[model samples]
Target: MNCADMLNNLDSSIDTLHTRTKLSEVILKKGISKKDELIEYLRAELSEAFDCRVGFWLQGSRKSHTLIKPVDKNSSYDIDVGVYLFFDAEDEGLSASEIKSTLKYALASYCEINDEPTLQDSKNACEGLKYSAFLTIDTPIYYIAHDNATPMLATDSGWVDSDPKAIQKWLTDAQDTDDKRALMKRIVRYLKAWINVKWNGTEHKKIPSLAINILVARHLKQFEREDDSFIHSTLSICEELEGFFKVENPLNGQDILTLTYEAEVFAHEKLTELKAACLEANDASELQKCLIFSRLFEHYFPQIELSAFNRISGLPVTVTVPELTINHYDKDDKHIRTLNINEVTVKKGESLTFSITNKAHFNQYCSAHWTVRNIGSQANDANDIGHKVVSSITESHQRGAAYTGSHTIECMIFNGATVVGANCIKVTVKPAFPVLRRKKIFKGFRR
Candidate 1:
């Protein structure tokens, strides 16, 4: 049931912006230099004209370390930069719209001289500068009164009481207080990757990354392995979202998941399906676990090769291990034809037999020790791992597919405990499709 190695491989596979640290050391060095220049220009222009002190800070995923690259290569990466204008007693009367307009004008001037990036009126909160086809920086305007007041964000209607830094602090503090290995950040990245694969286009309404960040932070837990931690956290959140699915902002206590009823229902259904898939994967063997995760995360998750798990470990390191190929047989003792070794599948409630062929000839007196390793929750609960070793000359092992899981069997040919040949085969047992029966109801009515 433990797929720790595969999970670790997946953790490293995701191409998040944080994973671009090495690349950022080069490319983002220029990006940051441009950002600094733009900031200096804005501060000089705004302070000279409006006669107010200006401050700036990074917010959103870039600051939280949960930023993921766009699933579509053509899409731009968004950087949220919070701009705070500290107004003196004289400039306190500036309206929210006026404050936003002043910021836009300054940004427009910078863009005009730069000649590389263009400006757009990203209504409501921020003014966006499309630095390049692949990148954008959003400047959300805010103001503080000299009398000491909370920061207010400029919106279409009016100024709103908010602080972008507070939200980031909440996430940072929560993560800092918890797992030191940054498991929370890893989980958030995984969920964001899932979101990108499931709903990244205009075809579907997107779930706010803020909501996911908050929900995951609230329900986060640490386990000995990342896979177990992820599954438990997902299940915890999905279970809590049973009645009214709402994710509140940790800093302000406001429902951040503001989605339409239909969209909300759709999201809940998808998350529920994800929870079920996680459970199913927990009950699967190593290879099956990889398949389940691959499907869950689409092309973003790695596809595992059978050769990775085709290792034999019984012989000594100095000894030259021999090779063997496995053959399958049905309950009728009939040869089950299979083109590949690991592609064997059987329906539950059926019995299958396995035999090995020693490609490297061993002594005739060599004993064939067959070992059956049953995996999955069902098998664990049954407490019947089939660890019972059978010694036979033919190297035949028979087992019933009583439980649905990915199970394996191994044959080691040993001459007085010194192994000569070894082989293992993975078998997937799945539930058989139910057969429906047609019954006669009324004369012409079908039930």
Candidate 2:
């Protein structure tokens, strides 16, 4: 079986997991309304307390429509709302620590009004007023120049150049269509889920969701199968991280992986393990694939009943199998290179010749029958199952790499009506020139 149906079912199952963690429309609407009310209240309080003009806007996952509850049920949803203070030539003496202190103090009264005891402060944001057990809003202060230059965030150490909304715009504008955009979100959510499950309740440093989003957007590619799209992105990311464990903020070109050297190595090893497991799942049988997914995703994926295809039939006495030789040819039919049967990856639009040589000496009138089977969305579109015999005299059978997927060709030696020897070869056909890079703006952040 191609396992497409099972994979589609797995996709739906993943959506179910996402739905469980994703905030509902009604809840989000209420959260937004409450958030806006708090923003207005804080705007008034800060302006009166600090004697400076300020602006408020939503940012982060909420604004980008990529918010999801953390995999750990104990963790609350974090919504980031930026508070910008426009500065002129006269406000040069203001300090980041002082501004953060004043903001936290002002939030104390609001938290009191909301029946919260105290306000919490982080390196970049002040956390205040939990709307519920599952939600908390974070206010990160920023100072904007009079000429409307890049905003500087009030960090614990000092003011640092930051534009919280730039990432949202970069992520949203990267995709061209709504479907592509939705798929991007799904991909990001899946990666987040993996990380959430990995480091839950552990002392190890957790990978930030921002880094995951950047990597997903960087490596995302659309495939005919949803499973293929996900596996390819994951494998591509693993390959990249294997060489170097670093990711840059798309807008300002800053390395976002702020983990200790030990932590970085740990995360890299774990991600490499994830890549290996994903590849194993891709090549596994249907039932085994479901189990691997369950373990990889913490049982969030569902199990589906799948049927396996019998690629071979008829049993015979032990005998030496026939030898199959494969050669790749260019457009002009010139011999380019011979492919190893164990690792044959052909490029689409190229021509390949498969010849069968009888290695076992059998004194009988034997005929060589060839069968080609194509598997994947591309093959399915062509409606080619390739069960019938294509060549009976089998000096060589030439075929074009017309599709991009894993396909197989088999040669069976038949003595009258009984099977004698058989050999099968699996070939992987890839696109002529695979798309490994995105827009030029994103090029610097990759390497």
lDDT of 2 by residue, 1-447 (tens): 333343343454333434433555555666677788789888999888666798988877787677865553345566789998877412677788888888887788787777633466455544455655456788888888765588888877777888877778888888888888877887777677677667766678878778888888889888886667778888998999899888998887888888988888779878987898789767776555544554455423322222121222223544447777789997677899986564478789888888765544653467776656555555433333233243454468887887898776766576775556666677789998898886556435554
- Find the 10 residues in a row with the least total lDDT in model 1: 15-24
Model 2's alpha-carbon lDDT is 0.68
lDDT of each: 0.66, 0.68
Give model 2's TM-score versus the native structure: 0.63
Report clashes for each candidate as comma-separated counts. Answer: 0, 1
TM of each candidate vs. truth:
0.62, 0.63
Model 1, residue 223: displacement in angstroms?
0.7
For each of the candidates, the C-alpha root-mean-square deviation to the true structure, in angstroms, is 21.8, 22.0
